[model samples]
Every structure is written in C-alpha cells, then in structure tokens.
Target: MPLVETAFQVVDAFTDKAFAGNPAAVMILEKFPADDILFKISREFNLSETAFIVPKYEGSTHEFHLRWFTPTAEVPLCGHATLASSHVLFTQMTEKQRQSGPLRFHTLSGELSVEFKTAAPEKLSTRNEMSLPELVMTPDLSIDRNVLCDAFGITENQILFVGSCHWGVLVEIDASTTPLHAIKPNFKAIASVNASAILLATQCGTDLHGEYDFISRMFAPNLGVNEDPVCGSAHSVLAHYYANKLKKSEFKAFQASARGGEIHVVYDAVAGRVRIAGDAVTVSKGVIYM
Candidate 1:
C-alpha cells in the first residue's frame, strides 16, 4: 500500500510581506495524529515550527495543539507558530467556520484566544491574546559576563543585562551602537550558562520614528533557532519592562531579524496578559507525501 500523506498550509506569521516573518507549517487534521508522525512531519517540513490541529470539545471549538521543533529538539511554547496556526484555521481552512469573531484554542500554554480583523487586500490581521504564566522578575542576573561576551563577540560593556523573567535572560543594547549584521553570537558559549533563551533589545528613542518604541532580536540556541523573526512570548516580558520604563501601556516593537517583523503590544497589568497584534500573509498551501 502507498504511504499516507498529509497536507498543510504554510503561513508566515507577524509579517504582511513574504519571507519577512517566521514560517510555520499548519496541519489541519480530522483527528489528532500520532506524536511520532507529527514529529516526523515537523522534521520533514524543517521550518522553525509546525502546528497540528484537531477538534477538541465540539466542532465549533477547535483545539489548536502546537509542538515546536527546531532541527534538534521540541519546545514548550512558540508564539509565531501559534499565531500562524490560528490564521490558517480562521482564514483558509473551512468556509463553514466563521471568520468575523474571536476563535478559542487550547494549547500547552492553556486556553488562548485570537481575534481576526480585515486589513488591506490579501492581508489578514489578528490579535493573539496569550495568557502568560506569572512572570518572576529578579535583579539577580547570575549570568557570566565573560560567557556573554564570548558568545556575541562583544565586550562586557556592550551587553546590558535588563533582568530575568522565568528562565529567560533579557539584555538591552543601544540601537545606534552596532548593527545586527556586524555582531555574531557564540551560541555554544551562551548555551552553557542558560539553555532557555536570550532576548536582545535596543531602545527606539523618540528621536527616531514615532511609530515604534523599540527594536529587538531573540536568540534561542537550545531550541535550534539562532534568531527568531518575531517573538510574542519575548514581548510579554518586554511589554512589562517597556511599559514601566516608558510609562506607556501601548507601543510598537520591531524585530530586526533577517526576516523583519513588527508587533503592536498592549500591556494589561491587571489581567496579566499581553496582547500582540500583527498581520499574517499566507505564502503557500500544499501537502506532504510521506
């Protein structure tokens, strides 16, 4: 008998332009497939991450279960993939599904909601409200200065340790100090100290464009991605930090990866949720023959 195959719609999340956002493979299956199969398909697709969908409570409520894999290992939660998966389901999957209202999804991170809106031609807009677990911020940044310098090929003075949230480390650099292309991080060295993830950011002072408040880059060596095009989880911490720093609840953030992206974030301090809004554009739709 021939091997069974599956098809998926690949979407670039957090970007309105092709090749500018994070690419994720969204597989809409009638029922939940085996874990091995999902892992294999994610490996085959070889994108930063892939999402698997199935009917959860009822036909109306979809369970968007996501498993993020790098070329090496799986991660707990991924923001861009989640956004892309929701976009595929709401915009492209089935006509019977309503496209005007908020869609709910259950994932490892817990119950999440995505609100869809119409943008310009060929562009779909979504605001993903992620229920981030309670964040723990501490002044105790035990990261070795030498390790950070070795990894990014920058001096200790070049790196500014912002704070620690959960298992991730936050750092800030001057926007005009150095360009992203000029600095290269030593993943191995950084990974030795902390294997979770690293966030590097720069202040987009009011002197620059007023559209955005800051620009940033995220690196997760343990998860297999050197740099993520756009990161929503990282923004959760950023939202709190910037909101306190700039004394604003709403701001725009630009991720300056090779595939650049922009995100509008709102900090709900009382609710402990961060709203990340952006545009997603579908680049291709196809099947995988296994």
Candidate 2:
C-alpha cells in the first residue's frame, strides 16, 4: 500500500511570541480523512484543539470547509483554532491566491469570514481580523449560587452568574478584591455543573496590566481541558458583556492562564457580530504519516 501522509502546522494563536499563547495543530488537506483518524490525530496532538481544513467547491462564503476537534469530541465553534487556520491560509497560501479578497470559511457554527490587512512595508508581521457571531448568553437560573461559588472556591459575593450559552455559564468575579489568577478551581466540582464549561472574568485593576480592560480564564473540564490558555469562542461572549458594561465598542482582553495571550475585540451592532483580531506565529511543521 502506498503511504499516505499529510502536512500539519503548529501555530501559537493570539500572541506574537511563541510559547505564550494557545497552541493549535492545523491540518490542511486536499480531502478530509475519516472521522476516526481526525479524532486520533487530535488525541495524539493533545493540544486544546486541532483544526482540519478542506477546500469548498461552492457557497456564498465557501472558500473552505473547516472543522474543529478536541481530544474528546468535535465542537461547534472554536476561536483560536479558527484564527490559527486563518493565519495559515493568509501566510502560507500563494500570494496571488490571497490577493483575491477576504477568506470565507464554512463552519458548523455558520459562515465566517476573515479579512487580511496589508502591513507597512517596513513591518514584518501581517494582521488579520475575523468577524464571529456574537454569542449572547442568558442568566442561568437553574444553578445554585452556593454550589457555583464552591466549585470556584470563591464566596457568593465574589461570583455572579452572568449568563449561560450553548457552551456553558459565564461567571464574573470581582477582580478588585481577588485577582483572576489567584483563584484555584476544583476541577472535579466544576465538572459537575450541567453546563459544558465555566468562563470566569474580572475587571482589570490598576495593579494588573493597564492596557487591558479585562482579564479572563476558561475552564472546560467537560471538554477535557483544565484550562484553555486562550479561548476565542469565550471572548465572543465576553465581548458583548464588556461592550455593554463599559459602553464601548472596542476592548482589549487578556487571558491570564499560565500561557497568557492578548485579544482585541470590536462589537459591530449593525451586523450583530464581534470582530476579533490577534496575532499568530507558526512554531513548527511536520508531516503526519498514517
């Protein structure tokens, strides 16, 4: 039998420097392999997420068909991996192919588009902006506040249930008193929640970084990750929350995980979507022989 091989790139999303942001394995294939193989590859990589891409023949926003898989299962949406995939397309594809216009991706969540902006002639880095569907969450009236607080090892006053989306609950913490990084969550207890994951956010204090408006941390034990270094999907939900709170359309956010990264968000009320911009750097590439 002829050996089958595919090329893959590992990118650090939401960061200019390597090893500081969420790392994602991006596989660009002529045709998608079997579902089992995808799962195996994702499990083998053991990253927060892995993305598979194949060219799309037709659709309004159908330049490519994209899918995301975690170690455990496939998810409807993923922000950093999507950003990483966009980085690969914008930087790796032929310059002529990239000059056409905005790149559109057909995803399970919906049709997503990424626009690339030409950088200054002197600048070496390229900038890409992605418009993602704003995920609005509603108050989760079912969860007990006490249990929720216990799960995060915080008091009731320190935590508030902002809302719940398809992925899970959004909880806001008072960073004024407790910094986002100080809280230690009981992953076992957090996993007991009915929701898919828990998003904890806090207002950035002066003691914290000044450039950022807020800092956040994502825990999705349900998805097999203790903490996501940088999560794009969660920020889609966070963007709306902060925009309304601060009455500002644009925001700078930091995910304060061990591997920290920055993300810029702009809310487009006219389109009802949030535009997320970030930097991604390719760390390495290799061929996967199956």
Candidate 3:
C-alpha cells in the first residue's frame, strides 16, 4: 500500500522572527510507519527533531499518540517538537478536530496537553504544556573532561558541573566567555564519554532584554544533533537548578542556538513539576500524498 504523510514547519517556543526558533518537521500518519522509514525521513529532513503522530486507545478522550525522534535515535521527551506537533494539529488538521480545544498526547515521557488559540494575521498558535517528571540528580561523573575541553577548545576549569539526570552531562559556563556559534563539540569523543546526551548552559543573569534569567544551548550528538535550538527536557532540569539557586519559582529562559528560542517556565515545587510554556507558529502547511 502507498504510504501517507503530512508535514508542517513548526516554530518552537520562540518569540522572534522566522528561522530563529527550532524548526521541526511534524508528520501525521494514518498508521504507524516502519522504524527504518521514520529514521530515513528524519535523516532526509535533517532538522533537530521530527515528530510522528498516531492514534491511541481509540476514543479514549486522548486525541493521539505522539513520538519524537532525532536524526539518529528516538528520545523520551522533546518539548519543542511537542509544541510543534500541537500547532500542526490545531491549524492544519480538520476543524472538527481543531475544536477539541486541547489535545492530549501519550508519549514516552508521559501524558501532555496542547491548547490552541487564534492569533493575528489569521495565524494560529498552540500552547503545549509538557509534563516534566521530577528530576533526580546523580553524582557519578563518568565523562572524560578532556573530550569536552577539546571540543569547545575551552579549559576544563571553566565547566561547572550542575547535575545529571536520565540524559547525561549538565554543565554551566560563563555567558560572556562562550559564543553560541563558536560551539563545536567532538561528537565522537563526547559520545565516548556519555551515552544519552549532554546539555551546556550559561548564566545570562538579567543581561538580555527579556524576562528570561539565563541563556542555554543543548548538544546531543549521541542522539544525532550537533546542537538543539531549544530543549524542553533540558529546561526541566534547568528549572530545578535555577530555582534552587535563585530561590524563585518562575523565570524566563532563552536558548541561544542558531535557531534561537525562548520559553516561559514555571517551577511548581509543591507539585514537583516544571511547566515549560511557549507558542508554536505554523510556517507551512501541506499534505504528502504517498
């Protein structure tokens, strides 16, 4: 049988112009496609991430089942893609489905909700609230400090260890000392040290003319991304780290990657959840008749 596909260009939680936000190619499938096919599509698109949607537990109140994949492998949770997928469903999907208000997705991370709203210029925006599970910081340091130093051409002393979660390394550096475009991680070497992924961030400390408190960049070569424009899961860990340090509950964060993006984060200490909220814009909409 012929394969069916649809694609949408979704701007991640970014408030600036086009191409500034993380662009994810979202595909809605009538049925689940083969793993090889999905990986092939991801490689062909060559974006930071791609999302595939399939129905789950027919008529169970939940709208669809979602999965996210990078160029090389699948990840547990992706905040930007989740927001993008919801935007695609709201603007491009049929009106009958669009009126559903909020869509529920069953993902590897957990159940997530995406709400839709109509904005100016006849454009639509979707607000995706990711359910960031509680983060458990680990003390084991298995990474080769030499590999990280060699990649960015920086000394090991500059890197400050924040903590580790299910992902991998979480390090912080001075915002002024490093430039976003200057990052060049040795994928092979970094992969050799860590298995899951690595997140590198810097403290903006109220420098940027925005509500965010800091700026960040995420690298997951092991997951087939040289650097992610904006990472939702990383922010979950970041929210915890910053909340503990700043003693604040809510703050703004910016991912200073080439495709820059912003996120409004709320840390619920009582609930043990970090809510990362952002608006997703639909740049293009079309169907793939396969």
Per-residue lDDT for 1-290 in model 3, tens only? 97655654545545434556787888877677788988887887788888998877654434788898888898888888887777666655565665666778888877777655543334445555555665656644676677778766668777766467776667776545555446666767666755577777766652342356877778787787877878887888788877887799888888877777778888888888888777777666666554
Candidate 2 residue-wise lDDT, 1-290, digit = tens = 88777889998888877787899999988778899999999999999999999988632232899999999989899999988898887876556656778888889999998887543223233567888998888877787787778777778887654689887789987766667777788888888888777899987772266679888999998888889999998988998888888888899899989899889999987788999998887888899998
Q: Relative to the unseen true structure, what is the C-alpha lDDT of residue 247 in candidate 2, on a scale of 0 to 100?
A: 86
Full candidate order by TM-score, most accurate first:
2, 1, 3
lDDT of 3 at 77: 85
Colliding residue pairs in candidate 3: 212-252
Error of 1 at 250 (Å): 0.6
Superposition TM-score, candidate 1 onto the true structure: 0.87
lDDT of 1: 0.71
Scanning candidate 3 in windows of ten residues, the lowest lDDT window is: 116-125
In model 2, where do residues sit more than 4 Å from their true spots?
A: 58-62, 118-125
Ranking by lDDT: 2, 3, 1
Task: Estimate, for each residue in 16-114, the C-alpha lDDT of model 1 and write its tens digit.
Answer: 777778888888777776777777887788887887777664565455545556556666667787788777766654444445456666766676777
Give each model a TM-score: 0.87, 0.93, 0.85
